[model samples]
Target: QWNILSDYFLCFLPEKQPVQIRENKRYESIKIVLSSSLSKVKFNFVLYLCENIFDRFLTFFQREEPLIHLLYHELNDLYRNVLLSFLKSDSVQQKSGQDLLNINFEQSALWISDKEIKIGRFDCERTRKLMSSLNFDEKKSFYQDVRKIYITIANYLKKNLLLNNMLLRDLQVLDHSSRTDQSSGDRIIRIARTIPNLLDDREIDKLENEWALYLVELVDRSWYIKDEYIDSNGNIQITHVASFLPAASQLRALRSMHRSCA
Candidate 1:
């Protein structure tokens, strides 16, 4: 059944050109290609097929648990190969004396950076679902493979890319906004607020404390207020070294008020 479906679908692949004119021609073409080693398939073509066709194919076997299980192994193999190709690609390699290229450090990070946090979350959620569906041995095997892939990518980025630091900075700012000064802290807080379930209670508290500490320090600095003047519109404009600091005390008080009320 899988073989018939695979053959039928192979003909539709744009990458496999010379569009087989007859059914026999299509079968023959698919047979020839399938007979050859999977290594013979182009990396980009396989990735394209996986992204476009394989997902749709899964829908057909939704009720067939056994077939779905088998397909998981096959898809895992394809995924590994595609990931290997991506890691080996010229774009991912470090360019001599050049600034790091901005690319996702992981499948999940890519989605998150694109403002699709749910997609990033789904990467882990999907794997967890798969693990739950599998037997012990299968779960162990899958877990090991996933761990290796994550570690490899992380180590590679650590050694070859500065983008990792940038990503770290983004996390720190968003997760611990209170540790940073006013403008950046406020900006991160605003952004973080929009993303529901982006951070847990511990993270939120940590960020709030970091922010409160920063505000306390700002108050101590005395540089919070730099200059004061009246604008042409007759509005009082106070220019501070860090414009966000004035609101910091108010924010701290509000947080305290909320805590007390709670």
Candidate 2:
């Protein structure tokens, strides 16, 4: 049985071709052509692999570490290449082009020293100083590159379904605690009330009504807010007022109430 299985597997293997070569010159010619072709293919494959190895590194880190230090070298190379390409392709005057080309391309090495990583020194103070040292056009070009990086990160998050995960976690965590929900609702209501220009009276009223309904529902369910009472049948009942209105009906009511108050 084992021999039969081995024979079946060997049948699926690719058949090797036998090479036919002459004794002297033809043999040398075949060897040279084969070696050169294989070397070229291997070099190209390795280069491509190295270029894309760090493409997904950002998604793995998830903003927990210092993004600037992690991206500094890669971003420097990217910005330098982009700047050079732009200068080469644009129809600028020769003198201005030369000036742009002459601009010193320096990478930020502030966060690293002697092959060791330095922590706590990569703050906004050092960053502001670095930006202030740049010339006007250089500053503009750097900011353009920064914007492109931001867009790239945002697109990556969207592509990998990370944005939805983050948003869902934020919503669930915020709504997990009754105190958190109440405090957040109160803050929103206060902001709406204090800043009439920010939120009109109608909007304020609508927000307050929605918040009130949410609070009522939360209070009805949360044992911390509402006490439990034993009824005649010995079943436990929450002592808070239950929301009479369904969610959709409550929102509609709130909207109408806001319009009336306005």
In order, candidate lDDTs are: 0.41, 0.38
Off by over 4 Å in 1: 1-23, 38-98, 102-172, 177-262
| Model 2 Cα lDDT, one tens digit per residue, 1-262 | 4235333333322233223333456545544544343333333323432343333453544644222212323333333333332233232223222233343323232112211211112322333444455567755554455434433533443344322222222222122243345455655455344433455677667766776666666444453324678899999876432213224533453344335434
Model 2: residue 108 alpha-carbon error in angstroms: 7.0
- The TM-scores of all predictions, comma-separated, are 0.23, 0.21
- Candidate 2, which segments miss by more than 4 Å at Cα? 1-179, 186-207, 216-246, 249-262
CA RMSD of each candidate after superposition = 21.3, 19.5
How much lDDT does candidate 2 score? Answer: 0.38
What's the true lDDT of residue 258 in model 1?
30
Q: Which candidate is the best by TM-score?
A: 1
Q: At residue 129, what lDDT does model 1 achieve?
A: 39
Worst 10 residues of 1 by lDDT: 111-120
**Lowest-sum lDDT 10-residue window in model 2:** 111-120
Candidate 1 lDDT score relative to the true structure: 0.41
Candidate 1: C-alpha RMSD after superposition: 21.3
